[model samples]
Structure formats: C-alpha cells, structure tokens
Target: MGLVGEVLLLPFAPVRGSAWVIGQVLNEAERLYYDPATVRAELAALEEELTSGAIDEEEFDRREDELLDRLEIGLARPAPEN
Candidate 1:
C-alpha cells in the first residue's frame, strides 16, 4: 500500500492499546497551545495513569516525550547567549 493508504488505514490497526494515549497526546498539544497550568495538570494526570498501570511504561514514555516536546515549544525562552 502507498503511504496515504497506510495512513488512512491507521485507525483500523487494532490499536485498542492506545486509546487514552491518543487522548493524552492531543490534550497535551491542546493545553500547550492554550495554558501552561492546564498542561501541568494534564501531565500530572498522565503521571497518575502511568503509576496506576492504566498506561504501560512504553506508552508512558512515548507520551511523556511528546508532552515534553510540546512543553518545550510552548515555554518562553531567555535571551540568546553571547
């Protein structure tokens, strides 16, 4: 299948494993796009999910990385070093 076909077929990939992860990742991006406090709250919830085994370590790690990336993009930066 072509890349577009593969992409279109993604939703049917039997990915019952990542329902919450999809939500979490989208929530992270949306919160980062809006409010830092909301992002922090979402991250806390993500951590809770990880601790409670609602999300496994690998999924946690992937979403954590994505959250951190969004956090980095959302955060303000200091002046450039000379």
Candidate 2:
C-alpha cells in the first residue's frame, strides 16, 4: 500500500499492526540518520509531507522524536564524543 493508505489505516489498524508500522517507521528514520548523506534528503521528504498536510503535526513530531532518539543511542560511538 502507498504512504497515504498507510497513514489513513494506522489509527484503525490492530494494536499489533500499529506497533509494527511504528517500528518500521522508526527503523527507516534510524537508517536515514545513521547515514548523514541520506538524512537531509529523507528528512526533507518527511518535512514536505508534513508541510503539504499529508501528515499531521503530531505524527511528524512523533516520528522526528523517534529518529533523534535512535540517532543518539543506536548511532552513538563506543567512546563519547569530544
């Protein structure tokens, strides 16, 4: 299904399905941030969707939060940054 379809279906979807969707989205965001080269492009696309009203502000903030958290922990180096 397309993104709009997924968004529309998210709320009404089963608990497990909603969780799965959230997880999938988080993973994608993680991927984008772990690689800076794609971060700007990917985030810009998400931002565009938000600006165009394709996604609500709450959803945008939730996803953005998840992305930042994942980048902080998952992408962290073994040693702390200087």
Candidate 3:
C-alpha cells in the first residue's frame, strides 16, 4: 500500500496488528503440532504417564490414538505455499 493508503488505515492499525499476531500464533502452533520430534516426545510422555498410573488404560489408549492420528494427518498434508 502507498503512504496515503497507510495513512487512511492508521485508525485500524490495532485491529490489523491483532490479526497479524493471531495468524503468527496459528502458524507456529501448526508447525509444532506437525513436528515428528514433538509427536514422539508426546508419545513418550504418554507412556510415562501410563507407567506411573497417572492415566488409566482407556484414557491412555484414547490419547495415543489421537496423537497417532495427528501425526498421520500432519504428514499427509501438502506443503504450504510460500
């Protein structure tokens, strides 16, 4: 946008900035969520929880399935456009 356009939108700066921040947060979150290392770490943690009796078998199975599904779906997604 030109200088004149920016000046005209100055009053909406806060809203635009908020949207930018939200987009950044979402992007980062997706990056971490799909990371293979992250998924492995979570699976290890879930195993520990089960071992220590922090979670029951049913709960552990449910969570493990969800994590596995996320890993699969994350990998299956197409690369984002630059």
Clashes of each: 0, 0, 0
1-79: candidate 1 lDDT, tens digit per residue = 7999989988877674477689878976665464655567778999999999899999989988877766776575333
Ranking 1 against 3 by TM-score, winner: 3
Question: What's the lDDT for all of these models?
Answer: 0.74, 0.72, 0.92
Task: State which candidate, 2 or 3, has the greater TM-score.
Answer: 3
Model 2 Cα lDDT, one tens digit per residue, 1-82:
7999889878877987878999989977755557544544566887999999999999999877776655555446343235
Q: What is the C-alpha RMSD of each candidate to the true structure, in Å?
A: 14.0, 16.3, 2.7
Worst 10 residues of 1 by lDDT: 73-82
| Candidate 3 TM-score versus the reference | 0.75
Per-candidate TM vs. native?
0.50, 0.44, 0.75
Top-scoring candidate (lDDT): 3
Over 4 Å off, model 2: 1-33, 73-75, 78-82
Question: In model 1, what is the error at residue 62, expressed in angstroms?
Answer: 0.4
Winner on lDDT between 1 and 2 is 1
